[model samples]
Target: MADVFDQIEWNVQKIFDGEPVCVHVGNAMECELKRHPSYPKFHTEAVRAGVQPASSSRLWESLIAMGRLSDLDGDCTWRLVILDCIIPSLRSVSARVSRDFRVDCEEIRSDMVATALEAWKDTATGVAPRNVRDRMVKAAFDAAFRQGKATSSERPMDDIEALSWQEPTAQDCKPRASSIIDVDDIRDADVAEQIRGERAGAMLQRWGCFDAVHSFHDEIRSGHRSGSAGQAVKTSRSRSLISNPNLYYYSSDLYPRHIGLSEAAGVMGIAESAAHRLIRTGQFPLPVARVGRSYKVSVRALMHFKDIPDAIIHVDDVENGALHARDAVP
Candidate 1:
C-alpha cells in the first residue's frame, strides 16, 4: 500500500494524464483553462491543450491557482499537487544550504516543506499572484535557514578580518583627497601597534573607536592630518546641527547615540510588547539592532526614515525626544 505522500503525489501526476499522457482526472477539471476572476493572468491561460499544467512553466501558475480553489472547496488534491510541484526545487535548495546552515539535508527538507505548507494557506490572496511556485521554494529555503541557525550548536564569530584591496591598479595607488599612505606610514608606528592590540577592526567599529584610530593614521601619514580630520568631523557635525543644535548638549560620554527599546515604546505611546510587534513586522521607521538581550534603535536612521527635520533623540529622557511625539509616523 502506498503512503499518503505517495498517494497525493500520484494524484498530482494524474493531472498530466491526458494528451501525451492519459486521462486520470477525467472531466473533473475543464479541458478549457480555468479562468479565476479573483486570480491574475499568470494564474490562467486562454487555451489549455498539448501542455501539462504542472510540467510547463507557463502553465504551472494556473495549476497552482486551480489547486488552491480545490483545497478551499474541501478537496485537498491541489495541496498535494502544490507540494509535488515544489519538491524538486526544495531538494536542490536543501542540498545547497544544508552545510552552511549546519542541518541534516533531510531535516532541512522537512523544515522547508513545513514552511511551504504554512505559506500555502495565503496563496489564494497573497500580495503577488505571479511567480507563485518559485517564491514558495525561496520562502521554504529562508525558513529552513532560520530554523537551522536557531537550532545549531555553533556560536557566531566575534572577530572579522579587515578587508584588503585586491590587485591594486595605478588609479588605486594614487593618493586621495582624504589622506595619504606611505610605505613607512602608520603601519610601522604606534597606530599599527594600537590597532593590533584591539580585538579586530570590526570590533573597533562597533566600539566607536575606529574613527579615533583612523584619525591617528591620517595624522601620521599627513603631518598636518589633524587639520583635515578635524574639518571632516566638524563638517559632519554641522549637518546634524542644521536642524537641532542641542544634539550634544549632554556630554557624548554620558549618553548613548541610540534610543532604548523601552524608551522608543514610551515615545510611540504604545506598550513595549506592542512596539516589539510593530518592530518585528517592519512597520516602524527605525531599524532595530539586537544587542545581547536588548534592542537599540539608531537616532540618525530613525530621523531619516521618518523625514523629520528636527528631533531630540539618543537622549536620556523620552519626553525631550522626537519619539515623544505621537505623530512620529503620522
Candidate 2:
C-alpha cells in the first residue's frame, strides 16, 4: 500500500507539476485513494489516532483529517490532493476517444493534459472548476478523429492507384456510361467545375474518403478553377452522390452505440432535465451526437463518470466440472 501510494504520488506530480489544484478535483483524488486496497488500513489507523471520517466525499477533507492523525504535514501533500480526480477524468475521456477513433489512448491523454494545463494557466484567476476537462477532451477528440480520417484516406488511395495502373480487360473497358449532360448546355467553366467538385466531394465522403472530401472542399474554398472540362464533368458526376439509406449501410456498425437522454440521466444519478441543462450549457463531459431532434449519448463516454472495472472474463473458472454437477437431484 505504501508502494501504491508512492506510485500514485509520483504520477500526480508528473500530471500537475505545480499547478493550482481545484476542490472538486481533490475530492476525485480522495475517491481514487479510497479504491486502493490499503485504504481500509489507513482509515483504521486514522480512527485509532482520533480523526473522524468526514461525511463529505471530498478528498481534501479526508486528507486533512488523516494528515492530522498521521502526524505527517506538508504543502506537497495538499498540492497533490486534487490530482486523483483530474487524472482519472482525463484518462477516461482519452480511453473513450481512443476506442471510438481507434487511436492511441496514452498519446491522446498526454496531449489533452498538456492542452488543459496550458488553458488552465492562461485563465485570469488560474481556476476553472467545470469547463477545463470538457474543453480538453473535446479538443483531443477532434484531433484524434482528424488523424484517423487522414490515415484512412492514405491507405485506400495507394490501393486505388495500384489498381488504376493495371491494363484494362475487355470487361473493364466496356462502356458503362450513364446519361451524360452535354457540355454545350453549360456556359461558364468555373460554375461547371464547382458543381462537379461538390458532387465528387460528396461521393468521396460517402465512400469513407473523409480526408479526400475535406481536401476537395478546401480546393473549392480556395477558388482553384484551372482543371479541364473533363475534370468538371468528373466532378459533376461525383458531387450529386447524396447520403441515402443505402449510402449509410455501415454507419450503424462504424459509429458507437448511443443511449437515450433518459438512460444518460439515470447513469449520472441526475434528473433528465438536469442532464439536458448540462448539454445545453455545454458543460457535459461527453458530447451528445444529435440524432434528429434527440441527443444520443455514448455508453463508453458514460463509463467515465463511474468507477467500473474492466469487463474481462477468465476461462479457468468453469473448468471444475460444474456442468455435470448441475441438476443432479432433479
Candidate 3:
C-alpha cells in the first residue's frame, strides 16, 4: 500500500519534471505556495492539511482551489497533489470496505482512487468547491461503499437516498445493498452509465491513466483521435462523451464497436445469465447482434444507455478485448 502511494507520488513528480510546460507551471505554483500565509512550516504540511483540513484552514482550500483549476485547465500536477493527500484516507477506506465486503483490499483501494477522481470531477462541476478535505473523503468513501461487490444485490433505485454513510457498529461485514450495482432495473442510459461509471473509473485508476484518458477524450472532441472512429466522429460529431455528455455515436476507437454478452455483463455489473435473459426476452436495451458464438452488445449503445467510460472501457481491453460466447477461461 505504501509502495502504491509512493509510486503514484513518484509518477506525478516525474511527469511534472519531464514536461517543460509542467515544469514551467509547477515552478510558478511552487512560488505561489511559498508566498501563501498558510505556507507550511514544512512543505508536506500543506498536504497534511489536505488530509484533514480544518474548518478555519484557508490554506488547504487555497491549495485545493488552485490544484483543481490547474487540473481542469490541463495541468495534472495539482490534481495529483490532491490525490496524494487522499491516499492515506483511501487506505483506511480500503481497509474498512475490504473487510466489510470480504474482498481484496487492493481492489478497494483502486476503487477508492477511482471514486475520488469521480468525486473530483463531480465537485468541479456541480458540488460546492469549499470544505476541501472532509467532503472529498466523504464523497469518495460513500461512493466506494456503493461500488462495493459488483455482483452484490443492488438496492432499489428509490432507496438510494437511504444509503447514507454510516460508521461500522456491528459484527455484520456485508456491504449495504445500496452500495452495490443493480443495473437490472435500469430503465435509461443515464442510469446504466452511472453504474458503468464505476467500472470505467476503476479501469483508469488501475491503469494510472487519468491524465491519458483526459487527453484521449480531448483528442476525440478536437478531431485528432487518429482512427477511423476519430474521423467518423469528427465528421458527424455526435458522441455523448463519457462523464461529460448526453449524446454519443458508435465509434470503433471507443471499442472495436461492440463486445461479447458476458463481457458486457461484467461491465454492466450484472450476472452473465441476467444479461442473456435480457437478450432472450428482448429487454437488453442496447442493440444486440449475433456475431458467431456470442451475442455482441453494442458498447457505445450501452454507453449511451448506461453512461460509463472505458466502453469508457471494458476490462477485456487490457488483454486484446476478446470475449467469445462460452469462451471458457482456462
Judging by lDDT against the true structure, name the best candidate. 3
- Shift in Å, residue 22, candidate 1: 9.4
Residue 249 in candidate 1, Cα distance off native in Å: 30
lDDT of 1 by residue, 58-117 (tens): 455555666666776887665665676556445544654454445676666667777787
C-alpha TM-score for every candidate: 0.37, 0.31, 0.37
Which of 1 and 3 is ahead in lDDT? 3
Residues 1-330 of candidate 3 have per-residue lDDT tens digits of: 454556666776576453322212345455533342221232356545543325545656666677877876788767776777566656655665554455666666666677777777766755445454555665566565565646234332211111112354543244423236565567875455344444343333333454554555566556566543533221222234333342233323544566788876654444465455446544455788998768887766665443333233222221221221112222
Full-model lDDT for every candidate: 0.44, 0.39, 0.50
Residue-level error in angstroms, candidate 1, position 279 = 24
| lDDT by residue (tens digit), candidate 2, 41-69 | 43344223221122322443444443233
How does candidate 1 score on lDDT?
0.44
For residue 76, give model 3's deviation from the true position in Å: 1.0
Give candidate 2's TM-score: 0.31
Angstrom error at residue 179, model 2: 31
Q: Runs in model 2 with CA error above 4 Å?
A: 1-81, 99-102, 124-259, 262-280, 284-330
Clashes of each: 1, 11, 12
State model 3's lDDT: 0.50
